[model samples]
Target: MSEGTAISDASASRAASSSAPLAERYAEAMIPVFGTPQRVLVRGEGCRVWDDAGRAYLDLLGGIAVNALGHGHPALVDALAKQAPQLAHVSNFFATEPQIELAETLLSLAGAPQGSGVFFANSGTEANEAAFKLARRHGGAERPRILALENSFHGRTMGALALTSKAAYREPFAPLPGGVEFIPSGDTAALEAALAPRDVAAVVAEPIQGEAGVRPLDPAYLRALREATRDTGTLLILDEVQTGIGRTGSWFAHQGVEGVVPDAMTLAKGLGGGFPIGAMIAFGPEVRGLLTAGQHGTTFGGNPLGAAVALAVLGTIREDGLLEHVRTLGESFAARVLALGDPRITEVRGAGLLRGIGLAEPIAPQVAAAALEAGFIVNAPDPSTIRIAPPLVITDQELGSFADALPALLDAAAPAAAGAAAPVDPSAAPAADDKDPS
Candidate 1:
């Protein structure tokens, strides 16, 4: 039998055994924000996972770039186990040592001084909220307008949502915070014109646009932003929520760029190494003091439990030299992918562990489904963009396995574009294998 036939058979079996019942349970209990749960994953370990049915998968998506150290890393598990037993919950009325230390460590990594401060939150959106508040408060009357890029994604909260450029996402939640303007990313002239009035509070951008299919900004454009913001005293906010913590093979994506020290930056996702935590790092005092004692607070933002987990994650990244690992592994991974010599791939773009494979056709969803059937986990940002943000600690051997499986995945996902028409939607398209994992 053909390989496609094998994949279809496997899909059929999984559907018949447990996938159907689990999907039905999800339909009854969960909101459809993310559609049905693609797989009922039950447990995971170092770049791999097992679904509820005991099938294993190489998790290349890394929990959407949240599992920097990968799932069930000893550091994170031990930290959580130790901290949870000692002190898990504490209100924001008091401060914690771990929080303060984590803040200082993050600042140091960002090339900021000792006096730099951080505001902790539970997720990237909340961290962005803190950064937004500080930016607006510091802008005063000079410029309250924030210039964002089109096709950029910050987060989903009301405040962050306003800065998000996707219409479908923003249309449902109207009346977002005012004074946010959209501009074409990497267009220096357009950015200058948008900020020329000096009425813009800050220019917010993702060093690498994660949600928009791993699009990266031009270095020259970033330098121009630095100069323009300085000329008009506008703040530059880099939302590194998905790009930071070694996912980019660097501490921060803007680190090597000249003359671009952002006033405020938001980080989350991989910061806690799979634990729930977020942070807003403010630099240069322009907007650090904008939030007063009671101006902003989160009840469980920097509690002992989260701080402990964050510290462990950071410590491991440093001690294990994951930055170097990401740099080396990412280069090899990208090179291997490029060598696939597949015509369907339009382009590949990324910094380090976080990358996107742009397909010539709108078959990303299909590609992802096919990959899942092959015991690999990946995500499609849009119909043509396949996002590949694996764990920062992912090994070359694991990536090699994925490299071998990828051609088959792309062929199955976009057979029509490759001269064969698919019989159904890619997401629901039946695979050929009925028993094989890969």
Candidate 2:
């Protein structure tokens, strides 16, 4: 189809659905991967989004940490507008300036040593998939085993899925690529035992396991992991998909821990400020040389448009000092939630904007629903964990609004939770395990 014809057809589809309930239209026209989106968002402007009914919501979830600058920020908008007309996409056979510049900036931010490199993809799962390939190539015939943390989330693609430890997301797809094992996260002895055989190719983990209820691994544990992996010749790959690009008040979440650097790092979510970009950075010469040329590639991986937008996001974060702002506001916001003295709220777990509000009972779903009804956006990653990873540019007032309404939201949810929440299974393990606040 011609470009103009395709545009017209899309516009016609929008017009046909103008009067219909978007939820019904969505159900009819789309697959239910996400089990029916809660709201049909029409548009957004800096920390707020509007539904089809014209109701506005404070977007505390920030598109699940993809909208680093919130919505429709001028810098991001300008970058997209400028880049699209100039040069949007090019085949991987030819390189673009934006792609080169973006890769360079990422390498610098990561503090990767000389001979480091980056491979770009279009989403979090794709980035993890690339990292998976890198791991396999490095392992080759000598080391075939891979280690991932229990309850950790990486991504959903086949290769990435193999590394993810969530049973629900993995069970249906098996038998996945073998030689991947789940070990207890943060248990030094378990990790040591896993590596003692010297057959494990790599260990993949998230600095903050966002989908596992925004849980942040201990810095000391991370340091030990790095040391042990180095000693054993295993690659330490940190999945920073949700916590990178100032989400956790740092360029990368692990940067908060001194003298700790992974052999490979995967990034996505907020990297392009919602522009659908992902990257895998290989540190040092040996790791960088893993996948030579034809071993792996993607058609849309390093498109100029995505690279330009990501550069804009990084530049904006640095220029506006959103890192420090995120740190200060996140601390204050967590404190405010705790100070509310609501019994339903157990404690806030995580750092910076990436946080999970621990609950006394399995009422997180009801609470998230209540928050949505009360014009705030949040989510329940698990039965007892309310995960909130708002935009880095979100202000004190924006967050304060949610905190002020949280008590009432909880009150609204109490009745529903009492009737609808699943009873805690005494024999089964807790879904969240309180997410280890310490």
Best by TM-score: 2
Local distance difference test values of all predictions, in order = 0.83, 0.89
Tens digits of lDDT, candidate 1, 1-438: 999999999877666765456767677657788877888887887888878777777888998999989989999999999988888987887777887788878888888854568889999999988888887887777777888899989889999999999999999889899889899998888988887776888888998998898988888988888889888988888999998888888888887577778878899999988888999988865467678888898987888898999889889999999999998888888888889888887777988888898888898888887778777888999889889899988888887777766777776766745667544323322222223242
Model 1 off-target regions past 4 Å?
1-20, 416-438
**Relative to the unseen true structure, what is the C-alpha lDDT of residue 103 in candidate 2, on a scale of 0 to 100?**
97
**Candidate 2 has which clashing residue pairs, if any?**
none
Q: Compared with the true structure, what per-residue lDDT tens digits does model 2 show for residues 39-121?
A: 88888888888787777777889999999999999999999999999999999999999999999999999999999999999
Please give the lDDT score for candidate 1: 0.83
TM-score of every candidate relative to the true structure = 0.90, 0.92
Taking every candidate in turn, the Cα RMSD to the unseen true structure, in Å, is 8.7, 7.4
